[model samples]
Every structure is written in C-alpha cells, then in structure tokens.
Target: MKRRTRLVSIVLAAVMLLLSACNINMGESKEPAKGTDSGPKTEVGAQKVVFWHAMGGATTKVVDQLVANFNASQDKVQVEAVYQGTYDDLLSKLKASMGTNEGPSVVQMYEIGSRFMIDSKLITPMQEFIDADQWDVSQLEPNISGYYTFENQLYSMPFNSSNPILYYNKDLFKDAGLDPESPPRTFEELKIAADTISKKGKAVGANFAIYGWFMEQLFANQGAEYVNNGNGRDDLATESLVNTEAGVKVLTWWKDLIDSKAANNLGRKTDDSKKAFSAGQVAMILDSTAALKGLVDSADGKFEVGTGFLPKPEGAGEGGVIVGGASLWMMNSRPEAEQKAAWEFIKFLTSPSEQAYWHINTGYFPITTKAYEEESVKENLKKFPQFQTAIDQLHQTKLVKATQGAVMGVFPEARQIVEGAIEEVLNNKKSPQQALDDAAKEITAKIQDYNRTVK
Candidate 1:
C-alpha cells in the first residue's frame, strides 16, 4: 500500500513539471508574435508642404503643372498648391486661421498686404533663406526686389509682378479720328483722345477699373511722393503728401474725365470693369498687364487691340510705375524642412523656363531676367508683340523708389476710403479737392491707428 501511494505522488509531480514547461514555452512565444504583428515601420520621407494661393483659371493650371513637375523632379519634397479665393478672401482667411495652428506653409500675398503681414509677424523674412543659401539675388530685377523688401530685408519673393499699361481698341481709335498706332503718351493727349472717342466711338472714351492701381501710377507719373522719406514704410505722423499739388491735379483730372463724360466710373470690382470693357463699352482701359490674357479671350477676335506704356502727366518726366501683383510669402507655421522645400519650389516656379511658360500662358510679366532672354519667350513675343509692352514699360521706368509703391499699413482700408472718395467725386456729391482731402484725412487716421497697434 505504501509503494502504490509513492508511485501516484511521483506521477502527479511529473505531470506538474510538464504543465510548468508548457506555460514557459507559451510565455516565450507571445513576445515574438507581438513584435511580428507590429509590422515593419515606414521610414518617413520628404515632408509634404501646402501652399495657399489666390490664383485661378489658367494660372491655377500653370501652378498645378509646376507643382507636378517639381514633385516628379525630386523625391525629397512634394508641394501642393491650393486656391484660397480672391486677394481679400485670402487675407480674411489667413487672419482667421491665425488663432489656430493650421495655416499653410506658403501664401500668395498682395502688394498692399506686405506691410500688414510684416506688422502681424505672419511671414518669415526670405532674406534669411537667401543669405543662408548664398543665392545670387542680383539676377532678379532690382525694382521687383525693391517691391518685396521691408527695412532692407525681403519678406516675400515677387512672383507675378506687373505694372499697369494702356490698352486701346484700334477700331475705336480709328473711328474716333485718332491714329490707331499712336497711343496717348501724355495725360493731356489721353484726355483729348478720350473726348474725341466719347463723341464718336460706341463706348466711353477711357476707364480705369482699378482705382488704387491708377492712383499709384498717377502719383508716380507726376513725380509726387505718396509718403515722406521715400520709403513707404514710414509712420503716418511723418506726413502724407497725397493731397499735395500733384495729387490735387490728378484728382481734378479724374473728375474732369467723369464730368465731361469722357470716361465712365465703373464699380470698384474688377469684374464690373472687365465686363464693361469686354462688351465694348470702354474704348480704352488703364489696367494691370495681368488682365491681358482675359481681355484677349473676351475679345473673341472681334477687335484689333494695342497695348502701350501708361500715359504720364504732362511735363512730369519719366518715372517708374509701382508694381502691382501677388507675391509668395513663407508662413511661420511650417517646419524647417518644409520651409526649405517651399523655398526650393519657389525657386522652381521662378526658374527661367517656368517664368517663360507662365508669361506666355498667363500674360504675367516674367519675374526673372533670364525669362526675358529665353528663346521660347523671344519667339512668343515675336508672335504677340503686346506681350512685350509690360516688359518695355518696366525697363523704361526710372528711379525706382518706395514712393512709387505705397506700402503703408492699413493700405487696403485706405484704398477703400480713396475709392469712396472717387465715387463721391464721380457722382458730383463732392468736389475733387474735397473728396481727396476727406480721403486723405480718413486714410491718415487709419494709418495712425495701425501704427499705434504695430508699435
């Protein structure tokens, strides 16, 4: 009986040992299985960057093609271009997005928004990157570079820079008994031609769809400084020469044009003005060269169009017209790698070939000198001589200065005030001097408020 009991205990001990070994094996198997289930990790590649732009239509297509080409050219980066609406919409969206940390890596900013962006600290100075890369900025046009520089440091790169040019309908000019080939070279000649066309032509003699652009060019052509110290970055307390003799003269001329029915005052919207011109309601227009493509498209081969340099004030001498176009600004919310990639994409977009393509396709002036020298651009220019009008005007400009391009904070609001003043004068509600003086005072007050906040 004792031997049988001992055998039973030995068998139970062996069974317990086997159970313990099985448990040990099961525990060891779990770790390898867990690790294998985790799967192979993906190595993160080039950072993806998002850019917000206010370009659409053919311009957007060009941008898409460029982005695709850039991505295909390199495996280290991918750039995505997003259309964020008009210039005003972009600004509003950007201001709203400031509260959140979800802004884009890059943004296309308007010329007037430069000061506001700088004051808000929303943009990263591009000069830092240029310095770090040891880039040859000398290759860029000095006037274009000057447009983007703030306190000697460039905050953005001028991408689609353009100046206003005079576009006339050749058929209308001939009908008005004016030389079709001889465009107005002076404001006096423009007034005469406009008066003649108003009597004979089917539409208004002359029109300027964009008031701020017209005022900028008018001030520059008259050799009048919009702000003191030559740099537009100064304070409102400094002085506002916008109501000076030259200003009053230009304002009066605009009033005379409207009063005489030589020119019609279309609403402030670009589309309104474009519609009027396209429908042959306006014989001539002073508008951005960027609109050349749209004008041609709208013409439908119905009229012979001629583009020429903007007419200057009589005896004002040759002066530069301020550039009016969008610029690419680097946002502060991006990572360093993404910022570098954004810069690379900017370089690609501004490359000679790319600039040429854009200029030919969109009618925007090439931002780089190399583009002007490209064989493709030359051939294209030969085919469309009007394409060179913007370039010629830009080259002929003298003494590039900030006074030519007003960069005051709250300039967008100031422009609205000025436009209101212009409307008042056009509607005969106020005299030219009164309207402009009121506008000047209002703009100065806004500038003061902006300066106080920024300071």
Candidate 2:
C-alpha cells in the first residue's frame, strides 16, 4: 500500500508539471491579457482605432489589404475597418453617432457631403496634422486634395476619387454600324450615334446613371454657371442661378432625347443602369469610372467594353468634369492617440503602392503623383490610355468658385428636388425652363430652412 501511494504521488506531480508548461506556452501564443502590456511599450500609441467606410467588393478587399498591411507595419496601432453602407447611410450613421458621441475615428464621406462635414465640425482639419507631421504634400497630385477643402481648410483626404466617363459596349456599337475605336466627341455626335443604335434595335440610346453628375458636367462643359459666380456655394440666390439659359438648354436637350425615344429612363439607381448596359439593353452609359470593375465582372467575357471621355456640348470649350468620389474624414471624437493612428493609416492608404492598387482595382484615379509615376500604373496606362481621361480633364479645370463645388447644407434634399425637376423635363410634364425654375424655388426654400438652423 505504501509503494502504490508513492507511485500515485509521483504521477500527479508529473501531470501538474506538464500542465504548467502547457499553460505558459498558451499564454505566450495568445493575445496580451486585458490591461496588460505584453508587447513592447511605445509612446504615442492607440489601443485600437475604428474606421467606418462604404467600400465593398474589390475596393473593400483593397481596403482590407491596406488595413492588414498597416497593422503589420506597426506595433502600436491596430485598425478595425467597418463597412457602414452607402454614402447616405454613412452620413445618417455619422449624424446619429455624433449625437451620442459614438462615432468612429475615421469615416469615408462623399464629395457632395464635404461642405456639410465641414460645417458640422464633425471632422478635424487635416492640414494641421499634415503640417505637424511635415508630410510631403508634394507627393500628391496638385489640388487633388483641394476638392475636400472648404473655406481654405482641408477637412478630408481624397481617397477614391473618380469622374464620370462614357462607357460603351463595343459589340453593340459594332452591331449598330458604329466604329468602336471612334467614340462620340460632341453631344450632337452622341445623339446621332445613339439614334442610329436605337433604330437598329441593338440597344436603347444613351443612359446616364447619376442625373446630378451628368447635369453638373454638362453645365461645366458648356461654361454654364450652375450657381452665381460659378460657385455652388453661398446662399439660395447663388444656387438658384442653375435656373439659367444654359441650364434650360441642357435640360431641353435631355428632354428631347427622352421625347424622341432615343433614351429611356433606366431609373436613378446606378446598379439598374449598369445592368442595362452590361446586358446590351443600353449601348452607351455615362457613369463613374469606379463602376468599371463591376461592368467588367458582369460582362463575363461576353462583350468588349470601351471607355472614353465624356461627350462635350456642341460648341463648348475644354472644361473639367466635377470630381465625384469619397474622401477620408478624421473624426474628432476619438482619443488623440487614436486620431494619430488614424492619420498614419490614412498615409498608408494614400501611399504610392496602395494608390496604385486602388486605381487598378477600382478604376478610380490615383490622387498621388507617385502613383501615376509608378511602373504598374504606367503599364496599365499604356494598355488603356482612356484611363487617364479624368486626369487630363482635371488639368483643364478652372475651379470657378465654391458654389461650383462647395454647396453645403440641404444638398441631399436639394439633389432630390433637382432630380424631380429632371424627371418632369424628361417626361414632358414641364418644359426645361419651367421645370428647372420650379426646382430652383423648391431647392431655395430648403436651403433657407437649412440656413436658419445653422445660423
């Protein structure tokens, strides 16, 4: 009995030792315990920072890879990327979060919302951070970051910047007896080609995905001021100037296309318009360059896609298409350390390699000059020269005034009013001048109400 008891005691001691060794290894392999600084202690570190964005698919993958690269490149920062839905959804969430002080450290915002973000004070001025870091602003494209600047202060960093382009189905174009290599350069040419294609029953004429963007580009191309002083900023009177001779002319042209059955209302939804184009239901589409990946994917090697510069007004001079894409806005609600981390992440994202990746993957123009100089970008550009169309357009931009691209306040509602006006004109419910005049009045009222609140 004594021998057996000694043996049992030896076995229990061995088992306990084994368990102790295993526990030590497990602890080392696992993350540091809460409140415990298991890794190297570093100054100016954040525990974790959250970023809210609306990017998805290939773009989302690119963002994820960038986040992973950033996390791996640093020891003191960990970033959590959260998808917050569409642009509107992101704004709604931001507003709600601000009310409760629960917003993310960074948010991806659309260009139209830049004014609102600046006015709300929801974002911090990025210029201060850039100056403090002594970052190389020269590495970026000139005035590329300026799109998000309001009142001479940079509120956000340009991320996925893009402009509308004319995408055509090569197969459809050929079927309609149009040369795929030679795209329409003027509105009249586009109309003629669209009419021919529609007559051939190969597809509907030309359809625009975003009516607002199309209108903006049309106005710019024709040197028509959408707002007084050509800036889309300031008071109601300034914005109401969109109800002008040039504006009426553009709207009238749109109405004529629909009235002649050369074009059809593909609906305001971008996806629907894309589907129509991909399925050969529509031969031509004016949409963001960002949609290239989707169109390519959905094409599934069935159709050849061609991209070209947006069609110009018949007598319009060289003009720039307004930039339309999202930017990265750093939130003020986060801890200073987290804010710094967020800035670092932003830098990583805007790095040349990341920008190249984003541009190649999403069809968005790279905001960094280094990205344009990179070999990968050069190779892609060599193969697809049309990809540089947006950059070329930017070079000729005059940037008339804030009201041209800096309208804040009730823009979302105002856009709806404008769209309604577009619908009325297209459907012949009202003439272009009458429709735009009515829209201007409605939009003016909304702007007044918004100004009252802000004042």
lDDT, model 2? 0.75
Write the residue-wise lDDT of candidate 2 on 216-285 in tens digits. 6677666665555335443433345568776787777677777777878866788889889988898888
lDDT per residue as tens, model 1, 270-331: 67877777888898888888888778778767787788888877887457688788899998
- In order of appearance, the predictions have TM-scores of 0.86, 0.84
Model 1 worst lDDT window (10 residues): 34-43
**Backbone clashes in each candidate structure, one number apiece?**
0, 5
Best by TM-score: 1
